[model samples]
Target: MDWERFARQMATMAHDLLEQDSVVGTLERIVRSATELVHGCDAAGILLMDGGRVRTLAATEPMVDASDRLQERLQEGPCFDAARLRDGERVYRIENMTVLQQRWPAYAPSARELGIGSMMGFLLFTENENLGALNLYSRLPGRFTETSETAAWVLASHAAVALSSARSHAQMTESVATRHVIGEAMGILMAGHHIAEDTAFNMLRRHSQDRNVKLREVAREVVELGALPRPEQPSRQ
Candidate 1:
């Protein structure tokens, strides 16, 4: 490996990750960078454990998704362990999936059949939160080396920070937009019904709770309809 060139590339990747417009874009860039920068990495993806179910994100190839599904079905794999934060390790590498008859016995052979000869998983985490696992896949046995693992570790570190930043920014933007919409709705209600601002807001909140809908959705309905809809009443039997 050209250490100098690799370092420069990693720097570029870090900048690119921060520049992504959304959380989804940041995740896509993270996986794409893995295939480009990690030696012997043929495909890559992120696996998120959502309510005990596997959610695969930004898969670079069908093989990546297939590997994730295999792990999800069998309930074990290096990526699964990394995402679930099991065994207290943030990084896992299977140097030879074809021969690994242990430590994921059910998953190794299936992964091999999916053209995954070796795999590496890095837990994307920060001080406050764990984002997910970034998984790299190769098509040839013994493809990943110690150097490859080092490269991926650095990439994962940068990826975690970038993903967190992206999500925060997106949330801030959405919050601002929601506030604007709600304010508009309140203003419309106050003008139409000659009610105070607090009363208008309370009405919206009551509607939201009664309908079991988001406050933003209720507010949007007020803005669009120029008035609050009547609450649904219980129907007589």
Candidate 2:
């Protein structure tokens, strides 16, 4: 298979998904595109790292999520190993789960019971960070060959970049919102105290230190309370 053509198609799909207004819509598109790109694969799934645990970002079938959850629970499998190692562009394929039992004794029987005869997993990374894995499961042995693995890798890399962009956008949006809230709180403090802006800021800092609270939490309470308590006066000498 010519990877150039596959790359072009995956890029187009990713671009279209990125244009969508919601992350859920984008993930749905990613899994659908991935399943179409790989041959002999009955299902496809994308795993994304969230707070140190991998979650099912999207999947072509519910069974795929179950299989992934098993791996997540077992904490040992091709996908987990690939992500931990940051093996971008790497593919691991096993012909039978029973043979894999020796290496992954916990994962093999459950995977086989789930009707997974062969498995191929591709690691997706962004720059230095390991994002997660794109997995393809097949019910027939020797289902994924070298050519299929390469095609899947091309699709997975583009998907990884798109997913990373979405996550970055979400973080930036949250940060801006937090800043807005803090600014509003500061304005409230300045207006209520009839004090200079710098003084109001210092009061907030002092209160945060004295109360053992976060600056943002203090700001939130000040905004809600509408007036801060008077600071205690030091005793006269």
Query: Candidate 1: lDDT of 86?
Result: 86
Pairs clashing within candidate 2: none
Please, what is the whole-model Cα lDDT of each candidate in the order they appear? 0.89, 0.75
The 10 consecutive residues of candidate 1 with the worst lDDT sum are 123-132
lDDT of 2 by residue, 72-143 (tens): 788877666666653443766676776745667888778888888888777765344535778888877778
**What is the alpha-carbon lDDT for the whole of candidate 1?**
0.89
Q: After superposing candidate 2 on the true structure, give the runs of residues whose Cα lies further than 4 Å from its correct spot.
A: 1-8, 22-24, 48-54, 86-89, 98-102, 126-131, 207-214, 221-237
Q: Pick the candidate with the highest TM-score.
A: 1
Candidate 1 C-alpha lDDT tens digits along 1-237:
899999999999999999899899999999999999999999999988764588887899999999888888999999988987888999988999768567899999988889889999988853344448999999998999999999999899889889889989999999999999999999999999899999999989988988999999999888888999777788999
lDDT of 1 at 202: 95
